[model samples]
Target: IFFVSIKLTVPLAYFYILLILVRELCEKFPGSLYIPIQTYLPYLASVVSTMQKSSTFVEVWAIIEALFYICLRLHIQWLQYKDPLEASLSSAPMLELWERRQLWERIMEIETDDPVSFVTGWFFDQDLQHITRYDVLDFVAWSMFEGRNQEHLTGDELGQLHDFVDELEWKISEHLNRSDSLIPEKNTDKNEVGDNRKDNQETPITSEFTQEKNDLDLSDGISSPRRDQGDRPRNQFRFPENVDDDSPDFFTNLYENYHNWYEQTKDRLENSDFHPVQGIRNYMAEKRQQIVEKEKNAMATASNLAENAYNRLVSPGSNMDKQLMALSHATQSQLMDAWNSMVEMKERLETAKFVSSKRKVLQQQLRGYRHLLDSARAMSSAIPSNQMADLMRKITQCNEAIERVEWSARDAFVKATGYARKNILQRTEPQRYAKYSHDPLLGISTYPLMFHLLILGVTDGGLRVILRRRGFERRTMGPIAYYFHPGSSDHTEDENEELNDEDREMTPIVFCHGIGIGLLFYLPLIDEMLRLGRPIFLPEIPYVTGFRPWQSP
Candidate 1:
């Protein structure tokens, strides 16, 4: 019945609009009539009836609607694609859980209906393949535990269920790995471009690196390098002879130990021969020892009294000179090591775009290393000795190179994550992508003209007024916080009479906006008054309101 009505109504509607256009054209120029649509009306009617009976018109309407939506989607994509920065910034990472609520609900429903089918079919579905692999593992684990509760299930059935779950977990991992590998390599290129563009703009880093003591002369603010030269009263600092050669190499050892421990722990967990608590405690202790030793060695390398004393004595210079040079060299070597560490960390961060929090940590670490590098350079320049100072400057240069690498790594991570998120959303839920991509364009295009009255007022010299009741400390002020504009809504008669009076009769309104926000805070109210052609008065307050620097009380 629905199809029959659609078939009948659509053709008649199209014909009705065509006849109206034809009538208007004929009336405007009687002699210009060409096709003579009136003569073919009966034939058109017969064709329409035939199409209705066969329901062929339904397909025609469908095709037309498809074309219309296609054009709409294209326009939306063009608007979003034209502004790439906006698109990247607006990429949603948790879109699957939030905006794709319907899809999640459907998955849960399917899982409830047949847990086994859900577990097996989930990995096969491409749209859902990018979802967190652990989430799938959890679901499979739950399904297995529930199956174990069924009294009707035999030992063979339970064993098969465990086997199926293991296979499903393996497949899910494979799918996630494939998805991660598919993340485009453009992130690295973007990082390079960002580094190059920010080279000149990285003044903060360069200045920080070359920063010096400013207390040499307060009156002239002139830097006196020699004034602080004799300030080093002791030769207490020293550098290890092989400071530059030592590489810590902690991550490699950590990874190896972790992998071996993980495999052994997995076997132990599955065997369940020993008590669970004691076995878990033993596994944890082994892991803790691995990490604790690595950290202890790293800290010892940073400061060792015996090693520093040996390096200083071997130099055989004036005690102070030898100590200064050794200290400079040690600082330089530490800066270089930090630089190398940051580069490696950034690369790892870029390659692993699955966790956003990891990227944030990498960024923070990069910033800290960069700051240390700059401080080394600044402190080097402040040293009076040329040789020691030169070493410090070299350290600064090494840090700058590391900074570039760090920036690239961060850029790569951000870009990769954004790319992955977009692809995942686009594949799993196209409507969500279309909505997110096009909604901004729609808002920009339609916002100003959404209400035709605003458009009409622009040319008509009419102002739009808005009346709002404001709350302050639980008390309400009605009509006091009002927007007055041309053609705006009417207010009380008393207010209108005063507004019309040649001589101002009403008391001037004094707006007391709370907080450090000064006159600029009341700009909206000021604008309304300007529109109404009224005078504005601004009173100066000592430290609270007008012309006052912001200060915390």
Candidate 2:
């Protein structure tokens, strides 16, 4: 009995001491329990039953040893089941609206000399939305023209530009055709209504027609032709009411003209005899002369205004203060008129087709108005201090507005020429795995190898089983495998009933292991965390697991 007791009691006492030590440590840490006390209840009951039945020390020790091995086996099974790396693959999340906007902003910020190649490479094998694709196409198209001379471009570069423009035009044409197809359906419905109420709606129809005509005249800056009532068609189709009557037809004509111009430019590029550069230089010289003449006229007007102000100031029986005020008011009025003209020019530029000649003319007119405003500003400096301050403030505001208009005009032109429809029709499969070279076991520690061979497998298997029992589901997203538990829903009813307000409000924890022994090493910590009743996400990083150096996802 003494020999048997020594053999059984020593191991049993050691196990009890270890358990006590663990309990004490858990108490000290305040919420960390490696294994809950309930886990030992079966062992405790068996020991009590053996002692009560007067069982021999050898039998008692055999029973204790068997129970210990059984517990170890259960742990190994749990580890295998709960392993995140073993999870199945899931689909990647779609990009949100704000994320796409941010992506576009970042793409626009990228500056490169070869924008076409850069854009194509960036978008290759990637799915993009229609508007986003168009925005990119427009940016590339405008970039080709920006600060680039047609004569200087190589054959390949010119061809590329031409091809991109053709694509852009095709996209625009497709959109217009789609819009046209929808138009007749809407018009037919309107025609049916008009036919049914012909007599009763005549007065209203006539009034609506007159209103539409007035609107077209005001917006298009062209008067509608007068037609006799007898000449009107019985089934006249009306377009959908829009701010710009030009709409699809105007854009279609503009693109067509641009295409012709592009063909002519391409021909010029190919021909050595025709010097388009020389013609462009001559045109620029003529514009410069016109600008000089306009500047002279502005100077003359300023001189005349000064002379009139001087005459008023020196004339007998004339109030000096009143004349100065009048001069200031006149200068302010001229500045206001110049600002209004700039605003009108800006509006025209925005609405006008992206024709080079029309853009240059409007830009020239804008410069002339700006010069006039500057001249008016210079004249106003001689006025009273208070009036000068007001004038300067107004001038600043006018300058800012003009700058914004110029930016808007540039953006509009780019959008008109550069944009194209979506190029990607279908998305390709996402990359799932990465290739890595194998490393030899020259410097690797022998202890880790031994531990993994002898101990790690069983522990990992047990951890997996434990996790599965706790209702954690495994899935793979892209290259990473992960385990997820839905917290409250996964928990038993008793556990949910036991949860406090704080536990209910606790945010989900994302637990990722470092470059060590993988997640199996963190089982104790994870087990403690599970008690909080919060959802957990565990993504497996294979490269850092130390088990496999070659195979990685």
Candidate 3:
């Protein structure tokens, strides 16, 4: 997600620079470039260009044509940086803008195969270094040529917008399609449906419906995909507790038969310190945590610097140059802070490098830890597995989040997608994050849409569309991380203490109420659904305000 956004921003930022130049130019010219249509038309009429004896009216017509050409060119170029609203647009601008908007929207909707991380493409063979930034640059250059002295967006910003959108989309989709991917597909039931319309294609599902595209129709009515239904194929999707072959357990058991392989793969070294699956996880987790904390601290510090810069910029009577200078200064400060942190961490690690002579002892300890984690990561519940009905219920809850962002911030969202940022204001507000009573059953509701959005790493139009229908604005917005409290080997969480009935089926529970209404208002009901049995991670929430003032780029 980060790389994608960076890739996108480079061009947008460049274009923004161009826009800044245009704005400065127009400000200098005043009536010459930015006059009203009335004033504009009269000026055009004053120019004389006719070869056939220049009469006042003839000369006026010639001047008007010249000015009209100029204005038309400007309008076309300005529209080139089309907004995300293109998908919903009823009309389009001239060639440059229209084509560019279409291209961007297509990029925005690009979907990747799941289980592949959003960062995957960016990292493949260090794809970032090899990535040509030209796709965005070309479109941007075209937009700036004749259009409004500026585009609705600068190219760099538009690129960043694309990355931002992509990342959010990836995170949201990931959250929805969790290993326990049941939510989004439940209502959109054609998942199992094969394309019956495709000739010679074997349809795996059994019922009236056919193909994934049949989603909208099936929810309205119960239309099974497979018509030639005999004995329904038993679910290939193996449950962990009630283990199925397709389940990880299926391979795990096979891998276990090769017990030594599970303990120590040949690739790691015959007597490598790296223990099998479990030990690596622990090592990775600890290492990852260290990285995360450093990152968080850096971001916090950078944010502080940005806030200070913004404060200075917005002081009344500050000139445009002052604001630009502040933006430059703030950006530099943040970058320097991040670089210093990274360097410090790198040096410390380098200096305290592990002693190789102790490798043998470390290997032994690693083996032990690895085995423990392998057992831990895979431990299924000893208790009876959750009922199918319960799982289905949670799936339904997650489905709701898939469409919530569409209508609420309709314009803001659409505009943001195309780089229409006016200034930074939070989408949600800062307040104490309200802690909710933990209902293991409410795991579905608490799964955290904002987290999911951030995790999947992008927001599409869906959330806003749903939000508008509900008529709620983003009262308070901010990032939130809901901790999923640890459970036993299986994925279940504890029931809310107040609501006794120990035997009552409880799924893994996560609590999220914090800072603003973004998480509090939108998430609760959804989290209630996704809880499974034990082996849960305890819930922890960390967030910053929805927005903080930063120098505008």
Candidate 2 structure quality by residue, lDDT tens digits, 29-61: 633442443355656434433344443564544
Give stretches of model 3 more than 4 Å off.
Answer: 1-53, 86-553
TM-score winner, 1 or 3 = 1
Candidate 2 stretches with Cα past 4 Å from truth are: 1-94, 97-459, 465-510, 537-539
Score candidate 2 by lDDT. 0.47
**Model 3 Cα RMSD, 1 decimal:** 34.3
Question: Candidate 1, residues 1-553: lDDT per residue as tens digits?
Answer: 7445543543454554454455556556645552453355656444433443444464555445445444545655565555332232222221211233344335444444333334435445433323333334334332332211222123433344334333333233333333333345454686665464334232322222212222223233222232223431111111112321222222223333444564577588778776544565587679879989987886687657756875766654667767889899998799677666656654553343322333345456545544553454345233233333343334444444444444444445455445553432121211121222223544322111112233344422222121212111112234122222223323456666667555343334444555443444565875565444333334423234321222111
Model 1 spans > 4 angstroms off: 1-8, 34-114, 121-132, 135-553
Q: List pairs with backbone clashes in candidate 1.
A: 209-374, 463-486, 465-488
RMSD of each: 34.4, 29.1, 34.3
Residue 192 of model 3 has an lDDT of 46
Q: Candidate 3 on 211-327: residue-level lDDT in tens?
A: 222222212222222212332222121101211111112222222234444234546654665544346557757987998999898888798887688688676556876888889
